[model samples]
Target chain A: MRSKRALRYGLLGLSAALIGVGLLRQEHLEVLGKAVRICLECVGIG
Target chain B: MSGMRRNRIKWPLSRQRTIQLISAALVNGYIAGFQKGRIFTGGTKAVCVPVLNCYSCPGALGACPIGALQTAVGGVKHHFPFYVLGLLMLFGVLLGRAVCGLLCPFGLVQDLLHKIPSPKVRVPKGLDRPARGIKYVVLLVFVILLPAFAVTETRVTPPYFCQYICPAGTLGGGIPLMLADPALRQLAGWLFNWKVLVLVVIAAASVLIHRPFCRYLCPLGAFYALFNRFSFFQMSLDAHKCVGCGACERVCPMAVEVTKDINSPECIRCGACQTACPTGAIAGPLKKQSPR
Candidate 1:
């Protein structure tokens, strides 16, 4: 993969990892939202 | 027939449309998946959407950022919405309503509705700024103060903005939920009818006005405005490259004066200016970048 795309994927992975931890530890509405928020933040709104 | 020159017909395919669709899909998908589980277990935490979506809407996965913040401010406890504010700032620092342009499903829906061939209203400048402030009042008063003071419970409820005004809730979650479940339908009353009326009016207005709700009534948009000055993913106009032709402003559906400053709170980073500029003066990051 191109370096930029690869780097983007890496960042995505890291964010997902962090969000997954947040979600697993707290199943509450506010906690689950952390996962989606993280995904959008990393993706940069397409 | 003589050899006559034929005009090439170009298809209208803007990258903005692609972005809006993708964001909507992701948010909607998450909301659908989230309903199976409960989000609030004990404490009040904030969930924020980068775009102006409603939190109470059944399909919403993340708490509406504006809603959460308002509720926090409005609820009797009146605590700072650290998570919601932080999350909103995170996106604002990164995308700057590149979220509104590309990812907001509701914004996309409005855009699609505006596509209908019809007479449209270009809100005059005299009324525009004042109109934009309404959402802020919503953010401050309805979402924040009311819940903080008016509630029976000490915990903050989702702000009234989502409950009464968010068209996204009416169109995305309300309509669908009512259609799918009899229990939800039975629960519907004058309040539901009122929401439906509001949605219908907004939907109709969208055909004539480009993103009327985003232009005037989205508190989430107001929050993003605070970060536009330094957002990493933004349309920067190299003043040297910009000839001040005002082409960007002319094409902007939101009617933002792009060359005045790249950091205008009103700018949605729709990339219209980038395409419109003959000098290639405008550009945005393909991915979120660390703020400068």
Candidate 2:
């Protein structure tokens, strides 16, 4: 039970750290840039 | 014969089905674009919803995590995909495959298809056991490795899964785009035909078999399944109350043996088992008990 709790916390902490760094780096804008454009390749058009 | 009997059982409108419908509608609610027959290119598309929605869909407001992950990994500037991974981990820890059962639009499609009045086919256990591993392979290869490593001369990675394999992308984005745009329709070729064929086969399979894509092909489902055992939301069996009748297993669309493994990776947390449980032995998001 202790181990399970520890693992959960560990994962949560890692995720938080990753998200924090991603936000700091402004990686979301990159995602936004890609999302806004309709990629013809994605739908097998190209 | 037993499977046929179970399928014939009149399943009344349940809380889970209601939730699924609302979730699907809410996720794809950007109807203004639908009228224009144009995909939303708005700021909200930056945010990835925790479902398998295509950003290229005419009415989609949010980005798809899988597509975003592929794009981030395939990008020339940054290859780590910290944002997508973090977001996915957050969703995984919170809901696990409960996202698949209650939140995904594609999942709703599969559920509705399986509900069509037709002869159902149960995947034989011998083939089913190994086939379940295929989704994991898709996650590892198509969603991750292929996009990250299969680079073009311009250093951009191709969205391989969306291009070649994703029926959801074909159905949600491609068909709509083709229907709306005269130029896109003219561009349709062997690749487009191939995707249409793939979508048709999967759609046909979903009618006979419950969630064939989710069971054997969805990379997103594969990723979420990893968190099933430890997610904050989880299914648990009150062994004391269970009569071992196996009714839960009988009704389970994901083929999960709920009595033996309440928290199995394949269990979608659709609450079918809970609704079917005669003694209410099954419960979820259970409060942690004090260690004895």
True contacts kept of each: 0.02, 0.61
Candidate 2 chain B has its poorest 10 consecutive residues by lDDT at: B1-10
Candidate topping lDDT: 2
TM-score of 1: 0.74
Q: lDDT of each structure?
A: 0.62, 0.85
Cα lDDT of model 1 by residue, B20-49, tens digit? 666776555544424542222212223456
Chain B of candidate 2 versus the native chain B: what TM-score? 0.93
lDDT of 2 by residue, B1-292 (tens): 2244234424676677778889878877878766667888888887789998888888888899998998898888747988889989988888989999989999989988887777788889999999999999999999889888888898988888888898888888888888888888999999999999999999999988999999999999999999988887888888888889999898899999888888899988898888788888888642232222
What's the lDDT for candidate 2? Answer: 0.85
Output the worst ten-in-a-row residue range by lDDT, candidate 1 chain A: A37-46
Candidate 2 lDDT, tens digit per residue, A1-46?
6887687778888888888888888888988998888877667785
TM-score of each: 0.74, 0.94
Candidate DockQ values, in order, are: 0.05, 0.74
Q: After superposition, how far is residue B127 of candidate 1 from its true place, in Å?
A: 1.4
- Best model per DockQ: 2
